[model samples]
Target: MSNPLQLEVERLLALGRTPEALAAGEAMASDWARQGQPLRALALCRVLLQLEPAHTRTPQLLADLYARPDAPAKGAPPAAAATLPRVPLFSQLGREPFMALLGALELRTFKAGQNLITEGEPGRSMFALADGQVDVVRLLEGGERRTLASMGEGEFFGEIALVSESPRLASVVATRHTVALELIRTRLERIALRYPAVGETVRTFYRERLLANVLRSNPVFTTLPPEQRQALARCFELRLVDAGTVIIEQGQKGDGLYLLLQGQCTPVLRHPDGKQSAFSSLREGDVFGEISLLLGQPASATVRAETPCHLLRLGRDAFEQNLASQPRVRAALMRLGTERLLHISKLLSGRAALEGDLRV
Candidate 1:
């Protein structure tokens, strides 16, 4: 059977590695012609000649790549053809505009088990995989490696690093021979200038995904309905709280709920007698300062960032405002609050029983 040379070429183009890609495209054309598959050969030839027109065979290939079957009307969209999953940027732009934008992008590819990103390195572009899978990895305290997750074709990553102008949080290693579409930050900024909505879409997508991840990890919110979960997500803002920062002060009116998205925090309780105790330590997905928000009272305890926490804060006023404007959001918040109350009540009751047993 003949190889899918055209598909392979598409993969390379998606990755923004054009120089070597041009050579691969030529090879595909040669192979196709050797197999007497003129149409396939012509498609690849067009791509090559587009890069280097003076190549002796350029004119003939150009004629063939543009050649049309008898039935189609002029200017009609090419007959429904198989294609890679649309990269997010192109998908957002639609057909004509996407193709227009593509003219300016470079193509690239990666071998299996290659690292696409590394922690602490500057990230100036985002990638969209057109084929193969990549593993998102991180190193642990003991130098042990862990797979945070894996993403496959049509999935996009490296976006947050570009948008936030921060170093990548996790490294991405290709698990299999891969081809990805890359959009440089400069190009993205240019597109954002022309189509601001695209930027908004990206931001909205980022926030929702981040919220969903944090919420999913907490037993408190994961059981809610999809619509409710989404509404709760909207009320939240993700913020990075530096280590040693005071996130909540005891005796101050609490206006927001804080969910740890990453890192840890220490909760401190101070008695009227001047006694102080470290009540608990929290890690990712743990939440604090929520009881005050729920009760509309002053904070009972202070919480300080222990190790540079990433937090998702949902302020009471914002929640109420969103509820007023969007009834569904209010419903979701109410449901979550009710569930949380029940959960805390159970925990408190269990602790009380343990104390009673100790006394006995």
Candidate 2:
């Protein structure tokens, strides 16, 4: 008899119904399964799985079909069906909803005491723990060293270097039989495109983590979880200035915004009357130049460092470009802008009310 299931799959594909074709293909595979035709079933299963990694039932059914006897007889063993990295957490994450997109991630094994990453070294890839344990350690002067933390299965590391674009913070060493899924930067960039939300989610997650880790140390982001605060931080770049540095002039075109991340500074606002007034003192977390950056106007004030300072500066072009790329960031900034306008309206209403009371 002609294979009715295969006929159905062909008809669906002919009609350009990819979803239905996949479904029909799966049913045909199942029919093959019932007849113990493992090889035939697995062949059909392969095509379906590739088209729809998120197709819920197909992965499990394919797993079952591949596990059946004679499935491996016709072809090399399926790569997906291979025993997952035996190290701690690799197998568990492979079952996650997003693992299919992590196709670029590769399983890597290392012997105990192997260095996963070294401090002060450049990094090209990040790793997620699949099995065993690794230690975050730092070597100090005088040959002293300290263990900062121990990470095990399902834990991820090396993300700081990748996300922050910085050198590795600390050395990582496998303390036992270890396995991990190494995610390369190129693959991550592709993931960022295919699943931009994944990158946004990851960025938000990392921002919060960094906030908590460096809040006390970095003044630029002390106000946690506030859209305005985060935007002000992200919309700028850090610049180091010596104690004698002149940051701004009293009357010049303001091309950027600035946020003080470290050290001390003084603000001097010059009036049209040829008089200067001390506007405010600046310290860590304080922001300035935003008035011009936001208004597209000239500088109304001068800024000079009282001491060596680290300042985050964001030029208009860079700020606008970044906002154009990240929708979430643009949304956050819009919300902040709305809030500020509303706040100013409320203040004006209160002042008008006070003026009426005096008139009365």
Ten-residue stretch with the least lDDT total in model 2: 351-360
In model 1, the Cα lDDT at residue 228 comes to 74
Candidate 1 ranges beyond 4 A from true positions: 1-7, 10-106, 120-124, 165-167, 190-195, 240-245, 271-281, 306-310, 317-360
Clashing pairs in 2: 87-131, 88-130, 88-131, 89-130, 89-131, 90-130, 237-313
- Over 1-360, each residue of candidate 1 has an lDDT whose tens digit, in order, gives 213643666654564446676767767666654444443444454456456655534323322222222323345334332121222343344333333334434445677779888866877777766556799999888988899999975577776654655566788998877766666777766766776765665666666766787767666565667787788888888787678999999889986877776677877766566766554477766766655665676776778888766688888787555433445433444455454444434443443212221100
lDDT of 1: 0.60
RMSD, one per candidate, in order = 9.4, 17.6
Whole-model Cα lDDT of every candidate shown, in order:
0.60, 0.56
> How much does candidate 1 score in TM-score?
0.61
C-alpha lDDT (0 to 100) for residue 331 of candidate 1: 49
Task: Tell me the deviation in Å of residue 126 in model 1.
Answer: 3.1
